[model samples]
Target: MKGDYNFFSDKKDDPLDAVCPKLSYQQRLWGFLICSGIGWFLEFCAFISFFQGNGKEFAIIFSIGNLVAIMSTLFLSGPKDQCKKMADKSRLISTIIFFSTLIVTLVLAFATDLTFLTLLMTLVQFCAYVWYVLSFIPFGQRMLKKFFSSCCEFE
Candidate 1:
């Protein structure tokens, strides 16, 4: 392939060709696995910190973990495509909310002494991440909507 052929971009060849031309499949997989493992470990630490009542620690560590986990996607798809997909119209709102809440969560944790508010923002950030991730799955957003409506809808 001359690498000019992005004609079938949605197919596998495009990213493999363009993104990390030097990285092999095994390298990408290994990178993802290592990063994901570290991310999960950090999240576990955040969980422990939450239970220990260290709101500051929990907020910072949890945010880092979430970011690292999201970063793992870069190993699977190149950043350009990943970003384009993230900002796709179908998921744009969720992506905006996720990023906005991420910054807000960090700010609440660092700029104020309000531990409880920091905790609340962290929870909101987590929810935003969930909403953002769901956009990647077909019908994920629709299924969640139906489920929420079922619970909230009144006769």
Candidate 2:
């Protein structure tokens, strides 16, 4: 008789043993929301600090940095096997969009008076940066696990 070489089959029954469990829909949504909220809070703090005349350069750099941090967190939270691929694609695309918007917004802000359009553009930029962070960062994964473990009531 030949010996079995099915390493995966032996471990299949233990659901929790999987490297990444499939999250429920609610878990996924909640995790995304929490991560986005965190990103927004961080950006809001940066904005407030910058408003105190820390310098326009500081504000611009901090905005970019926040975007990068959020994306990094999202990339890290993905399944280990998919992390490299997802991070490379997501980070590259996000960086391009973030910087382009930043430059354009800065130009607009300087070229024109601080009117409604300027405020709108600034808000859009902040929201875009926050969105990238929440979507790409490992923040969603961490939040999901923490929430599911503590608050979920399984029947």
Candidate 3:
């Protein structure tokens, strides 16, 4: 008599399998570097402009803003086990920091001595901030996607 039997049907589901993919080390590193580098460059330009008598107060404020934004972005993007968990939050926080910096600059410009150099530096900083933010969205998305895909593949 032959007995019918089922084999290989006892596999337990893995909790890790259900988790969302995370960014790869290389991708995360690259993204962080790019964001931070741009932030530093913006700050550097602001500092130089301030030394040139281009609204020292405004330049300082804007430079601080850039630094805060960069730090926040890095913190939010740090080695997240789940990328989705922080993506939206990071974007929101960065946006807030960017706008706050703008508001601070405007207030300083009006409240303090608004010189020609100050006006140009402030305007340039604003333009640079906008460009940086806009560029980040796409760059971040691409980098994050690559990171996730690579992570999943690794798994």
Candidate 4:
């Protein structure tokens, strides 16, 4: 099994090949979900302790949990193939939804008031997160793929 002959390998066999394998979409999605769950739990615990005046412990937990969440989210969103397939309209829509969600979440996180409107916005943010996840699902992926394919057919 010479390295030159192995197209599936990640790197060359100069005794320094990294063992990172390409994950399937399901694997990446599940990994992202699990890490997110763990990260959220750690953040919740940290927030609780922080509110209880345990500043040092809160900082430690908060930093570690956020590190995990950020890293996993960056790395475990599957391959970049789907990104290349996205149409301009789909990309624009996704970007708008993402930024809008971010704005709402930020406001909800820091706002002191707990009005009915705030609660309603929180619910909308939750639904937006669900939709954000759906945008990476196969249906969205296929839509992007088809967008490109149909354009190619016309051209």
Say which candidate scores most in TM-score: 1
Expressed as tens digits, the lDDT of each residue in 1-155 for candidate 1 is 54343332445455434555446668878878998889889999999999998998899999999889888877766666778888889999998998888888898888999899999989999999988888998999889999999999888
* Model 2, span 1-155: residue lDDT tens: 13432232332323332333444445545665676666566666756755775434334544555554444333223334334434476565655565566666666656755445555566667656655454556776367567778887767
Better of 2 and 4 by TM-score: 4
Candidate with more favorable, higher lDDT: 1 or 2: 1
Our tally of clashes for model 4 stands at: 0
Model 3 root mean square deviation, Cα atoms = 18.0
Steric clash count of candidate 1: 0
2 against 3, candidate with superior lDDT? 3
Taken over the whole model, the C-alpha lDDT of each candidate is: 0.83, 0.52, 0.54, 0.53
RMSD of each: 3.4, 13.8, 18.0, 11.1
Better of 1 and 3 by TM-score: 1
Off by over 4 Å in 1: 1-21, 153-155
Rank all candidate structures by their lDDT, best first, as comma-separated numbers.
Answer: 1, 3, 4, 2
lDDT of 4 at 31: 74
What are the models' TM-scores? 0.84, 0.37, 0.36, 0.41
